[model samples]
Target chain A: MTPVLQIKNLQVSYYTDAGRARALDGVDLTLTAGEKLGLVGESGSGKSTMALAMMRMIKPPGRIEGGQVIVDGTDLMTLSEQTMLKARLSKIAYIPQGAMNSLNPVTRIGAQMVDAIKAHDEGSSRADIDRRCKLALESVDLSSSVFKMYAHELSGGMKQRACIAISILLKPKVIIADEPTSALDVVTQRQVMETIDRVQKQIGAAVILIGHDMGLMAQFVDKVAVMYTGRIMELSSVRDMFTDPKHPYAQALIRSLPNLENKGVFNGIPGMAPALLQLPGGCAFHPRCSKVMENCKTQRPPSTNISGGRILECHLYSEKA
Target chain B: MIKLIIRRLLFLITVIWAASTIVFFIPRISQKNPVRERFATLAISGGFSPKDLEVIIASYNTKFGLDKPLFEQYTDYLSSISRFDLGVSYNKYPRTVLELIMDSLPWTIVLLLVTTVLSFVIGNLLGAIAAWPRAPRWLRTFATPFILLQGVPPVLMGVLLLFFIGFKLKLAPLGGAYSTGVIPDWSSLTFIWDVVWHQILPGLALLLGSVGGWTLSMRGMGITIQGEDYVNFAEHKGLGGYTIFKDYYLRNALLPQATGLALALGGVVVSAIVIESQFGLPGIGRVLDAAIRSNDFLVIYGVVLFVTIAVATLMVLMEFIYPLLDPRIRNE
Candidate 1:
């Protein structure tokens, strides 16, 4: 089956004061229908940038230097902003980082919803719009009264849910959620995560979940792709990757997690992700990898497929597919 | 709320009283006394004897109630103010200080109020447009020159522009609210045209300096507010421009501007003096300047007291209006 979202050899760079910072480099990924793929990476690993590039929402100083973000059959990179906008909220909805920040504080949430809903379908009637808004809120476990309240009145989790509701109201075929639950408290995070999972399943929309916490993403997503320094380090079924990861970096990451089944000291990743502007030669993660060898410095590894449909990029995976 | 109002009212009263107290004494404390100046002028010009001068001074002092103790004099001054009697102008010789102020009051109000509101509205709109993310750079390119012009002092601008635009270019009248040949008429059309013609110089002076500051401030407010989460939310929703303007820019920007306006109300009244004098416009500022020069104490006192009270009252009114514009303040 054709993928719902196809990103081919995507590269994004920003012209900052310090010079060109490669936000994403030669990254390739895809999401199929009803697939919940978690794009896992630390803060500067380009997960968020990839999502923004897909929507053609990248602002100045940041440019998608080379990329083709194909959603359904249309390539968004070639589309005009006006056409991209029609695609943006309707074909692929984006739940931005902070839900509260994604709402107009002075406007009623319902009015904002109607505005977003009508922007794509100008012919939508008030009654139908109101019904859709009510259903949207209800689908996310929010009461219809919540729509009357301004953004400031809602708790962090409720705001996130409301944003999610707005995004899913049009039943976009693909949803790019960038760190939706990252800012919420543990209980609220659980509730928000549950709501996202429930909604995506009910709508059967492809979800590109962007986050840094592997453990959290593992609990909710079907597949996981680990990123480092703007490059995908590993892509696999979450179960297999957790059970028997091939990449040393991925293995170290999973081993570093605090296991509730065993009492032990939990260690975070040894070093930070490489700075995109000053990335090391060859494999970017080689500097932090304990199993690093001399070959890892001069030669960039081609992706090698391993057990259970996993892909790893390392000198150890030097062989091509 | 009542206590707050009472407290504010008392504070305003105290400020006005302090203003009157200063008005009564600051001029008297100046190196030359009005009595001595008048006596010397008469003596040098060979008009009066020593006894005549002394008698004249005593009579004038007694008539103005200046012969009494300072506190008693203060009470009398306050009482007269309460009774709406601003006393007589010594230099103007016959007209009461109240009548002089009343005559000039309309001209100043027409110039200042109209210019202030115009600059504020236009400046803020331009500022908001200039700060928009995808807005054409031409907006800022065009707006910067106006802001630069606003920075120049109003008196200097008023005089220079008056010379260039009025005298040299001969586009408008150089001074006065109406032609000297035209008699003061009360017909609506005549009144409107007279006010408009008279407003030209002073209005330009006020707007040239003021519009820039308002534009710069409003642009700054716009840039800051655009970063606000609520504004970002609106952009994502792709709402209409007017809705964005009202909900995002106007709602957020008005609070700071209102607070500035409260202080402006006080500062604004004193500011027109230089421009008013430059234009030779019959306004409180020009009268106040002449009063200071001639040591016409009653007229000077009357102008200072009236402006202080007007400013104080406007500021109090601003305090009441602030809460409605700013939810944060209202909640407090």
Candidate 2:
């Protein structure tokens, strides 16, 4: 499969009165066309930051320090600000984290969708744009009548689906859905996830599904990238990840999930994720890693590649390699 | 919506009735007789003797129906007000209060309405721009001076403007509604231009003083709205800065500001009184001022009633218009 989106050593930092917070610390990720990558991490593991930095939507105090976000063979970092704007929602669209408020409340859903299309492709006829927008709405399991509704008029599931419809309006090459199913119930969450899954397949767009729900991630994603302190600790097929995880952090994360075998018995990873402002030397997860060696506290391990295209970043994996 | 309108209108009538009744009795509490007060000011100037003044006052009271019992006069006042017959002005003899208000109403309405609207537009635009993160530095600078000017009351601004623009610079007329000797003709463009020109200074005072308030409020609202998830998502949708600012940013921010505009329009009477009197424009403010000094109780009642009705009606109109601006309010 051709890689539709590639992040090379992506680094993002937030300048503050206290100190610079390295949000995305030399992060690297790749998602091929039509593939779903579940990015599972605890809160503030740079999941949302990575999404924003890809779109270059980071507000002030937070800056994309350096990175190459190459989508469909085009290096987005090299594009001019004007071209970057056109590139967004056309080349790489972002379905925002807060689906509840991701749409303009004062405008009609059809208007919001139409405006997005207009912003990107201005030469299209009004009728054509209307048809496409309505079609996009319908594809997300919403009626074409939803086009005339306001954000407040829709249910939580409908709003999320509406956001998904908007993201697919331009048939973007890469769709980054940042926690789209949050603030939804289990049934609504499954529905929203299914809508996203169906839409991604229809558009042939790679999707980076960011969430902390291991169960939901297990069901929807073909592959999983376990993140810790702004870096992916392991990336592997979902089968190997749940069956035989490599990285100690990924193992801990998987073990932390509630299973039928561990009924009413919760197993949480010890210690907290390190602060971005002052990450521990070597591996940022060294403080919490159960399989830490003496060298693990001094030497940050490189990403070790194994058979079947799996990746693990840890002293144990590299020592074995 | 029809139910809401009817409910609001009924509430409005209750408020107006309460206000009219209070206005009727408040002036009556004073011991001063309108006829005697009117003649005293005229006599001081006319050099009239007081030999038959008491008998003349009694006869005048009888003629004006002021000799009736308090409850009887109140019922008569209410009945006459219900018919929209504001009694004749004691100060301006034989001229009805409604007639005086009508003659002066147009001037105040035009000046106040134009100034209020101009300031609202300028202020909201400048304010929204000022708060916009992507707006050019120079475009944002326009709001600061207005915010600073908000501290200077419109009445004071009028005095300063009159002194500089009128007296010192001679850019416009010193005072009054039109050029001293021009006959008022609605058909003549020059007369209208002259009237507008004469109003420039007072208009400026009102505009400069008021635009800041709108800018401040709008800027504050814009700050909140621009940071909303929808606005950020609009950017993520790759919308141009102008589209985001106008549709996503300004449209949402202007919701509360629109309501503020209604209240601003309603509250302009105090400013109108100072502005119209200072500029010597023949607006209701000046007429009301004259009536108050002469204790022309009926004319005072008439002006108060007019202002109350205008304010109450505008508030109701604002309520009906609000849901159109904010969709969330529509269902509620």
Candidate 3:
């Protein structure tokens, strides 16, 4: 089956007083139709930058330097600013980090949802738009009455679900949820994830879930990608990723989680995440890698396709080849 | 909501009572009889004093209920005021205070109310555009001149406008509500046009001075509002710039500005008095100025009470409009 979304050589930089910070450096990823990819990393690991760059929502001071985000065979980079607006939410919908303050408090939820639908499909009737909005709300397990409610009236979980309802209004080819459940309680988190999972399946759209919850990733996503600095260190099926992680950074990240065998102990990777402006030479993860070697300090690793459907980017794998 | 309005009405009555009471008693503290004051000017001007001048003053005071005990005078004043019986003017004589107010109030309301609202609209729109990132640089800078003009006091601004635009340029009439020869004709559109034409300089003075303040405050509010997540989300929803600007950006920014509008209404009469007197317009401000000069206690109390009621009523109306604009204030 053909992939629905393909991002190649994506690079984003922020020009600050100190220097240019390479937030996303030559990243590549592909998601097939109906596939779910969980993007996990530490804070400042360019996870959200990747999501923003995909939407071409990067503001001033931060620029998408170079990239080809081809969604459903259309290069989003080539579209005009006006067309780019239409492309967003219609081609690639984004569910924002909805812990708080996503919806407009002054307007009713129905107007918010209806506006998004109207923005894309201008010719649709008010009745048609209302039907679609209520339908989407219902699909997310929210009551149809929520359409008439304000953002403040809804509970936190309802607001998150309302955001999900808005994201799926057009049923875009790819959905990028940026830590959608970070503010939710564990029970509500599961409900929201299930809602996202159900909606993605219904729309047959690929989803990129960005968060630090590895357990949630294993439970929900088909594949997992571990990001370090600005690059994806490894992309693998969730089974192999948890069973046998290849990149030292990915291995340390998985090991950091509390497992049955390691009852009370956590194995956090040593050393701080270096600032993007001052990233080390060659390999970014070298200083913190348990398997650091001389070449690891001087030579950058290329992404290698190993046996089975997996991708690894590490000097250890490259050295053997 | 009904309860709220009732409470607000009761509160409005209390405020008017307190204000009118203060106006009534403060002028009396000087213990100078308005009747005597009125005739004293006449007596001094003629260079001859009537031997029974005190008798004439006493008869006038008793006629106006001013000769009663202070407490009885206050109660009589409250009762008469409640009945809307503002006594005859001492300076203009024979014309009741209410008649004087009724004659000039339309001029003040039409000019000051229109200018206040217009400045608010023009200033806010300019401010919003100035703060909007998508607006062209020149369009954004359009609000800058207004901001600079905001620091100029209305009085000075009026004088300068009157001097330059009125006297030198002759772009508008020097002062007065209308031309000298024009007969007062409410049915004639030309009469209305002449009235409006005469007000241009004073209106411009008030507009130029106050528009800048709205632009300054609105620009600040616009900047903060554009950064809100809802505005950003509106863009991400693929909304047009206009849609986001109006619904998400401008609508939210206007919440605090509406309160500013309410507070700004209180200063309307003050500016009107300054601009009207400078322009020689016969608005209620001129009436108040003449009343204070001649110590026409009834006229002073009448005009002050009228202004107090209008402002108090408007502030209460703004409170009602507030909940409509901001839903958070509703259902409380």
Query: Cα lDDT of all candidates, in order?
Result: 0.81, 0.91, 0.91
Clashing pairs in 2: none
> What fraction of the native alpha-carbon contacts across the interface, defined at 8 angstroms, is recovered by model 3?
0.59
**Segments of candidate 3 deviating more than 4 angstroms:** A259-266
Model 1, span A1-321: residue lDDT tens: 779888898989999999999988988888888899988767898888888787776788999999788888788889876777677677888887877577766567898788788877889889999999999999999999987877777889999999999889888889988888878888998899899999999988999999877767889998988888788889999898789877888888788878877667767778877788898988888899888989788788887777687778987876544
Task: List runs of model 2 lying over 4 Å from the truth.
Answer: none
Best by DockQ: 2
Q: Score the docking of each candidate (DockQ).
A: 0.40, 0.83, 0.68
Write the residue-wise lDDT of candidate 2 on A5-102 in tens digits: 99999999999998999998888888889999999889989999999999988887999989899999999989999999999999999888888888
The CAPRI class of candidate 3 is medium
TM of each candidate vs. truth: 0.89, 0.97, 0.96
lDDT of 3 by residue, A191-220 (tens): 999999999999999999999888888999
True contacts kept of 1: 0.32
Q: lDDT winner between 2 and 3, please give it.
A: 3
Give the lDDT of residue B254 in candidate 1.
62
Q: State the lDDT at A209 in candidate 1.
A: 90
* Candidates in descending DockQ order: 2, 3, 1
The 10-residue segment of model 1 chain A with minimum total lDDT is A99-108
